[model samples]
Target: MPTLTRRIRRTAATAVAVAVAAGSALTLTGTAPAHAHTGPRAATSSTVTSAQLTAGLYQSAYSERNRVLWATSAVGRPPVTRSSLLKVDPGTLQVQAAYTPPVTDAATGAVEAVYGIAVDDEHNTVWTTNTRNDTVAVYSQRDGRHLATLPGVAHAREIVVDERRNLAWASSFGDGTVVAFDTRTYKEKKRVTVAGTQPAGLALNERTGTVYAADLGGDRIVEVSPYAKEPRLIPTGDGPISVALSADGRTAYTADQAAGALSVVDLRKGAVTRTVPTGAGALSVAADRRSGNVLVANRAAGHVTVVDPRKGAVVETLATGANPNHVTIVRGTAFVMDKSAVGPERQDQAHRIRVGR
Candidate 1:
């Protein structure tokens, strides 16, 4: 896929364009209450609840140490002037505080807009991707204070922190590279380039210090190891935008956006074992370690699909909101962040779902 096309497909905030391009056939409108669409064994509506948080919500991360949720949002298109880093209460689904990024150009009202977010529990900081600025920013998890802005990243997308290694790894979608930074010093440590691939979402195997990146353009997963000279590639379903590993780290799950499916890959074999159709524009995915289930955010389909990896089937489809961008699992609970639908009154929302087996 071309870089431009991949960019459009990857951004759920631009819902209309993505829906049309992906052939979602969604009738996006104002005052359209988000509803749950369940399968035969789907979780009931009682298991899911939503709260209108803000507009342009992209991704969220749960801080285990602080027991809080950190979210990122960037308003409008390019030259994005307004953006915020929100500290949310995980249990109440309430915004505790919001912090604005530092202004880049006063004349244009451009600030360091953040889109993707990750919590660094070991360092007590939050890392976010400044996509427009081609950099990554760090903030204090306790008080939401701007700590540092590291530049030179090309279209930074998703980030993951290795608490055991005391390092943060961010995927650069524009240049097909994943850069590692030392959490303690806030300095660049290494840059691993994946040739001819646009790396989007990232997952880290803390046990081995291996990083797995979803190649949005290449339709594969790039495995980067600290000791290896080159990254290895594992083929997956079409347009694998987001990736997550099972609790045991023996398998990988990818939300295949273009194919609207979940590609399950066995890490030891380095091959996709099954492709489970999720929903339209399957975007983000997270594995519930406790339940051993995989939750996928179907952006165009306007819901989150809960898949039983053992059965290789979608057991439940819970409607979150329009353009569910990402899913983050903490202690068996799933937090879904969705962008605004294609309407004036449609606003972004955060959903807390008790994903029970």
Candidate 2:
């Protein structure tokens, strides 16, 4: 196994390489902001509000059952010492409760910091990806209590829950595999491998029990069906980091970080039908069910671009904070987590945008 330091360095190098390949000059340490394309093309009627959260905020999920939001945070590089799971009030964006992760090494004070989060409302639990420690953990959504930690998830990037099937699927970016676990037992149930692809973000189709993974390294989407013997691959644009499914499940949208575009894939045809230019460092995407508008988080541009699938154009641009890492839409509201620039004084923030229909 590679040392923690080596793993972190490798991941950073890969990210830089991907950015360059996608024709972007952005680097891990570079703080230069990428300009967003705005004008009459952008929407002028969207309401956006923000709140300062803790540092190192990476991703967030909304729990319809609990009526709250869950987020994960981890500060510093390898040997990360500061990390917490936060429960926030969706309306006010206030931190209702915070739970610290258990220390892994007593002498060194190392912790299993989490980076990605997903909520399983059916079971009233939350799942988090401990990317630094290569593991996944479950927690109680009611009180922010630790439930269980399952190890051996190499570089876990994202997780999604299938409440109907009682399963949770996680993507292993380092090993190009998606592993499934029984939600009730928290045991590894199946592992589906997508050779030569680094799976980053995951989206599940509840109606079909099919999981779609964004292939960051291969520029494609890996489709894993419950009944299929082999997974299917649908080609996408350069450096597709995150993905979202349309309301009808007929189209899949990808945030191509390297290309600074959103690739719309026709699920039935298994091909990219359109590539719409979004902005630089498009890290995450979410589809609003009410208006059917797709929201893309542009990390380098420090804004969120709202696109109308029917028109194939950007309708509005909402300026988020620096480094918008992830966006999740819940009940017609979009929650964006921004990991404000790299520094001790720079606190992360969460933005709530009401994407009007």
Candidate 3:
């Protein structure tokens, strides 16, 4: 999966070509995201010591009220066979529960290649993206019971649950769009056509009803709205693998893997305000809603930097195991998952670090 981030690093000329052919999909909206802010900010440094939370982990979905984490496990990369999901305790680092979703298609007997996982805590259900099968599944978050299956999302990457809207959204990298569905009945809602060959990640602001897609091929972040006829596409740094929007939905921080930096985008201005150097292989990003800190996983550098978006600076660095690509803060602890994630084995697993204030 290390090379997956490099799937769309094109020359500037090549990128422009893609944009022009697709009707301004790649049109550079703002200047390249700024790498620095106005004045000298306070130099803040913090490191988090960590320990293993257990194995059999992949993409993560967390529940604040339940204090549980739902991370997926796959046997194969695509069309994952014999895979399952584990419900984990963030505080104790113990697997509280586990559920193996049913094979989605009976004719092909296609096993769920669960990639992007999200939880609807309000309804006690879990939504998962079956990338291999081009489908999405919902199960009981309470007991792992199979609830329903919704088809039509192709090459699904990550999913976001909009609690406010009672809707779930999945990014279709292969199809070049984002699909939304009803959280309760698994009904099709809307499909947001976005730019890039790969929309590797998705971030949502439930309050604002704004969704941001990290367009890797197009090298930009596309602001998605259900009400708007056209999406707000803003170009950013190279190899944008993941995106995270601020609590206010005014700032969007994109993890640019090829550029090895974090692109800070001003949502309202539709421009990149700053580009902060994170480290090699800035793959995954998360915006801490409670603290307003942007957590980035530098996979090659083997550390997670807690970035202060307002100051455009990296304040804390959490040293962890190698190839730390995926990161999320669940219940006060920052759990970093490695891209080289293998089966339930602990030898190559990642450590969950306690994020400090």
Per residue, candidate 2 scores C-alpha lDDT tens digits across 57-102 of: 9999987555678899999987889999988777667677789988
Position 156, candidate 2: lDDT: 97
Query: How well does each candidate superpose onto the true structure, as a TM-score?
Result: 0.87, 0.88, 0.81
lDDT (0 to 1) per candidate: 0.84, 0.83, 0.71
Which parts of model 2 have CA positions greater than 4 angstroms off? 1-44, 341-345
Candidate 1 TM-score, C-alpha based: 0.87
Per-model C-alpha RMSD: 10.1, 11.5, 13.9
The better candidate by lDDT, 2 or 3, is: 2
Candidate 3 at residue 168, lDDT?
A: 92
| Candidate 1 lDDT, 219-284, residue by residue in tens | 899999887888899999999999999988889999999999999999889899999999999999
Q: Which should have the higher TM-score, number 2 or number 3?
A: 2
Q: After TM-score superposition, what is the CA distance of residue 260 in candidate 2 from its true location, in Å?
A: 0.7
Residues 1-357, model 3: lDDT tens digits: 113212322221121111111111111112121222222432333334433433445677666545566777665453445677777655444456667778756765557766678888667788888877778889887788888878888888888888778789888889789888987778998887754457779898877777888999888887788778888888888999899887787788999999989999987788888899888999999887767878898888877777778888776666666777588765345666664433244422444554445
